[model samples]
Target chain A: MADKPLILAVDHNRRNLELMSQFLGQEGYEIIAAASLEEFDQVLGKQADIKLALVDIAGFDRSVWERCERLRAENIPFIIISPRQSAAIQQAGLAHGARGVLVKPLAVKELLGLIRSLLGE
Target chain B: MSEKRLPTGIPGLDEVLQGGFIPGRAYLARGGPGTGKTTLGLHFLTAGAANGEKALFITLGEPEAMIRQNAERMGFDLSNVAFLDLSPTPEFFAQVETYDIFSPAEVEREPTTRKIVEQVEKLQPSRVFIDAMTQFRYLAADPFQYRKQVLSFLRFLVERGTTVLFTSEGSAEAPDADLQFLSDGVIDLEYAPEGRILAVTKFRGSDFLSGRHSMRLGERGMEVFPRLVPEVYRREFALEVISSGVPELDELLHGGLERGTITIITGPSGVGKTTLGLQFMKEAAGRGERSVVYTFEEGVETLVGRCEAINIPVHAMMERGTLEVVKVEPLRYTPDEFARLVRREVEEEGSHIVMIDSIAGYRLSLRGEDLVSHLHALCKYLSNMGVTTLLINEVEYITGEFRATEVGISYLADNIIFLRFLEMRGELHKAIGVLKKRLSDFEKTLREFQITRYGVKVGAPLTGLRGILSGTPELIE
Candidate 1:
């Protein structure tokens, strides 16, 4: 059997985090949840083999950008998630080194497809 | 009696206050953290500076650099504004001692307020902002003495024609009601579970907006929004027919939704309330008009997927900035925060149509606590903005009388469109009716509806039905 991809989802909204975790978990992915940048750092320190991350832009602070920049330097892939799907925000996310931007209440199938493409699945 | 006015420079705010703040008078801005008090003070002074008036911002607790950084993020160029930082020093202590002549121990403990006043005097600014007054409370052992000192400092500013905006951290019961009373005006910022709300607790000698209004701190600064009043709304805007996105439903609504008015779509569980709301959003977005959907029940992706099934292309509209979808669980937010989020979409995105998918979900998420007032405030706020608001309300069952829970929302709404499941010939059928529309004449008929791949379609009316409200109607065969 193929190894389960470790997916990290960061969001301050607990309900959203839980929903995303459940949805992704049902699809054979190991979901790691981080509520804030502080918790995200702790998770990153412990879980060294995270294949991808879906960071909620609403919960994102300035620190998240710096962390994403560091992740880019280390060749780790991350996607920006937001309820707002404005072109300006999408462009800004791309400029910040995000592989893609997922507009929220995400399409599970589309998100999965994007993740698979990014992971070369 | 003519009063001096201080312009906040925020367009709507200036208009609401009949030009601006009472000139040469001190105002107290009190709120907890993230309440936009600091932002308002900054905007006040920065706005003054923009108008060629010298403004000074004195920092007592936070570092000057931190304030500058925050301002930069909000797009406030504070370079022209004077910054006086009084962190720790004998001079700060001496100023504290002078201000705390009534309470020496308080002065010896925290000297920020006194130093703030000294800086104000030195700068001789046309406008002044004391970042906060919370730190000063610790200086006084007695609350009475603290109030006295605050009054003295405010008097000093008023005497010099320096319009001062003093920010403090606390709710109404913040042990500084006396101080608030002493100020010429008191602007209270509150973070409710729904959204960020700002209230003018007291604006002396002026007919200011009295009740709490929704506001948000955005790229421009503090944007003060006016509350919606349905009675006034009926006076200003004309009502036009709006499509329910279902052809049958459109016929039921007498050719469509009443335009430039409020519409309430009330239904029971699994009655396709959200689907109906989404259809309206889709139609509005399709027309190239901006529409925003706030769903407490569905996620943005789920909503998008549903839209895709209905062939609505919501993501394309969102990318074009013509459509915005926000999923807000009431449990995850206060009333004030929710209002702020709505304000951001309305102001920043210029959304003309807004849909709240099921107020029942919002009520359930909030656990039915003070939601009615919040809704009332929100409805009033949206109506005043002339934004056509569609509020989806979920009823437990269609049998009960058509009345809003406690908040009396039906009375507050400019229009009410009731959705229900009526059983015809022992088979369940969707039905809709226009209960009330304030301005326009709408057909009073219970029309049948169907949920199809395209969206809701309003079929012909169910003839020969008296107990339609009971959900069991005998249709003419």
Candidate 2:
């Protein structure tokens, strides 16, 4: 197992994806990025070390859920990132086996705390 | 397809959507700056919260704090709505570039789409609003890649049963036709120089009432007015003229005023336009005719005082339950709300006659590109209801040969009465003329008039005014 937690981030917006990746990358964790579900699937197939995936809920559709479900079945923990923090969404995320929900314009420190709690860091 | 829709709570907007936004279907709102797109989106989200649906707003270009401040300024409560900031970073761009095996530079430039999907799965909001989508344009150099990323993001949202409204700054250069075409619905907002009017260019999958309508951003978010179509205009039929409360003036109108027809009492400023409107209301009330006066130019106190001076006894009518007065400061009400209010009064009060103190006041209050269309819709609505309507319009130069130059309004009036200031021998005198009366045959000749403590009195026509046709009248020697 990798000593540092492995995180995969997916988003269509380059700026957001970059920001989240950099924020998480500097905190002594390995970060991977994918622009689409197809690319994300390919990355998962190639790299099995990713322990957590951060997904942007805005403008995302069902294939994303399918992929997340597959990851959950494999016992890999995932966190849902969204601009909206509605109770319904949070509940849905939790029910879908995500460890927790992270509302965006993300705070690096808060996200780190959540990851540590989920991974026993 | 089986997903639920979120109601926007805007009067006409929900109707346009055939109820509300399609539940779980993402939509695109495209516009240029000052188009009220953001305000509209915010209104939808806030209204959703009020309706017991949770809303989440994600800001890409602007700071979350600034978004909250602006929402408050627009009178929207964001306390119930969630805010998230997920701005892109550089290393994320590098990771996305690694996947672009074709171009190393592209790999370094594009952002990851997987991260965004992860966030959506986590938040699982019922409704989502992305402040803007322009930020993604730089992620992929090729349009194909950009489309793929956008499609993937949208698909993720739809699968989770999330209704999303994405705003994009429409650019004249390299318009995003592909993005617009991909969305379930598109609303184009435009701002024009004339009258500073905002108009909705088009809305797909709906029976959109065509024509430029007016919109304004005021203390109450964005208000839209759907303009009238040409098919609703009709010829006036001869009906009973109800008294305007001023006994003698009612005689000048050949009775009271025609019922179920538009009677336009136009004049220059300070010619008792509002006073005449109030008088009509008082008369209608005295006869047990339910009536309401919506005034844009005067305050409630001013209207009451002016009626008191004329001894019309407006307060007595109000007390008797036959009259209702609504004094509107144009800035406070949106055109849509104003129209809705009129509909309510007509329905609830069973008002026989409706009076707008001055059309100019209405115009100034709901300043939008579709001024004519808005008036058309208002007139059509009232006329179709068979409600006798009186509209007062103030003209700057009322002295000209009776002509209506303002666009899209002259044809709307069943009767046009011109009140002018006639200059004779270095003295200014008021005059009244029936320029056009659709139902009744009247004297077309211009006649002199006087305003006294008693009210308006008609006199003989000025025989030798050569330049009256030009609006600059010259007195006969």
Candidate 3:
């Protein structure tokens, strides 16, 4: 289990975080879920085994970009999930070194394929 | 083998269906809100329950408690009916966090399907009613998947020998055309300016009545009135004439109006057209035959009083069960509903003579529908039943132009007995004559007509007068 690739999932919604854990867990990947900024920072402190991240940027302040910058410096590949898509949001997400920006209501197949490719599995 | 039918708990609806729904098949009741779709489903389930069959109501849009309460008030006994309450609860809103990530089709469909399958296996109900099957559309990721799921779900129930009746609340944005196509039968409910109409457009494996029948949603729940088809009802009768109990009047009509034929007693207002119809009924009453007068323009008491003043003895006739005067309020009933009332009188009460007080009042009751077609169907139906029908047609014009019937419905009349207001010798007088008689030859002469406290009096043919139809007559030398 320790040798299994680990992923960090952050969302303000507990049910969405649990759904991601259950879906990705069935694919043989370990998950670390955080429902708030405080929990996200605590998981980030001990995130040495974290292979990738999926951050849903809803219900967060502007300080969330700082965390994204910190993830980039740590050389972690992550995807940003937004409630809506726009050119400004896409440009901002890319400037923050996100691997991809996905809108909310993500398709399960697309989300799984992106996670597999990001983990190089 | 003859197909087994399950009555829909509505007798009129069963008649429209020719028997009832085909057993072990799925039917879709499609309509907008407040069109009685759910109420129709309740009738289906309760009907099965009454027959000692296990019935299940799967409520998705409305709570089961509310449905049971409503059905109870409508005199429906839901004691033996089982309910599968799949409607959303307070917990659904409390757990709003589950709305995203996985689609509802992925997260919710499994448990919903499991619950339905488990309940069905345990109870094994013979009838299933889904309040609104459109709720399943939310449990599907796409339209194609929704169609497939619905097809399989219906198949599963039908294979178990369960007759399914489902409702769909369709909208302009999301029409249930696909579900309609998949259904073995489709009953569409619509609200029109006249009244609520229900039509069965598609019925597989059997035939159904093919027009928009009238429906009513009242305290007793939904009631359907099938359209009257004249060719379907017939009775053999002799080609005999009925007398008007008057010597001169019967002479003008050759004998009198023929049995099983339609007569139009047309005249201006207050020209005693209705009294003339009552004259024939008075004679029938002396013979112990029943007559029903559907008075659309006058109250029952008013008409009865007028007839009594003319020595018709309508009160005695009603007391003896030989006459009934029905007051049909305007805009109160659809044409089909009025036809049903007449049918009850003729078919059940054994009425020999049926009279509609006036044609214009009947047209007014129709709201805005075509008067001629409705009257034609009713008259044809009455004719087929071998019942003498008298229509009191009040033309708009009291005089001047020579017209037999102003409403342009003389073609519907088997005998046209027209009364005219003529000016003779600078005095306003009434003249009665026969314009057309389809069955026999009528006297080609106009006679003086008068209504008195004694009764109707007809004089000899006024051969000395000409231009009687022009409302101004001249003496012939």
Q: Which lDDT values do the candidates have, in the order given?
A: 0.73, 0.71, 0.90
A29: Cα error in model 1, Å: 87
Predicted candidate 3 versus true structure: per-residue lDDT over B232-304, tens digit per residue = 9998887888899999999999899899999998988888899889999999999999999998889998888
Binned by DockQ into CAPRI classes (incorrect, acceptable, medium, high), candidate 2 is incorrect
Tens digits of lDDT, candidate 2, B336-400: 55776787787677788888877777888764445666777787788877788888887776566
Q: Local error of candidate 2 at B134, Å?
A: 2.6
Q: What is the lDDT of candidate 2?
A: 0.71
What stretches of model 2 exceed 4 Å from their correct place? A1-121, B1-5, B16-18, B72-75, B79-84, B88-112, B172-174, B194-204, B228-241, B244-255, B266-277, B288-306, B315-351, B356-377, B393-411, B416-477
**For model 2 chain B, where is the 10-residue window of minimal lDDT?**
B97-106
Candidate number with the higher DockQ (2 or 3): 3
DockQ of each: 0.01, 0.02, 0.49
DockQ of 1: 0.01
Tens-digit lDDT track of model 2 for A1-121: 4487788887766656666666677777888888778877898789887878877766578667888888888788888886666998888788888888877555555777988787786
Per-model B-chain TM-score = 0.68, 0.70, 0.97
lDDT of model 3 at position B312: 93
RMSD of every candidate to native, in Å, equals 28.8, 15.2, 3.5
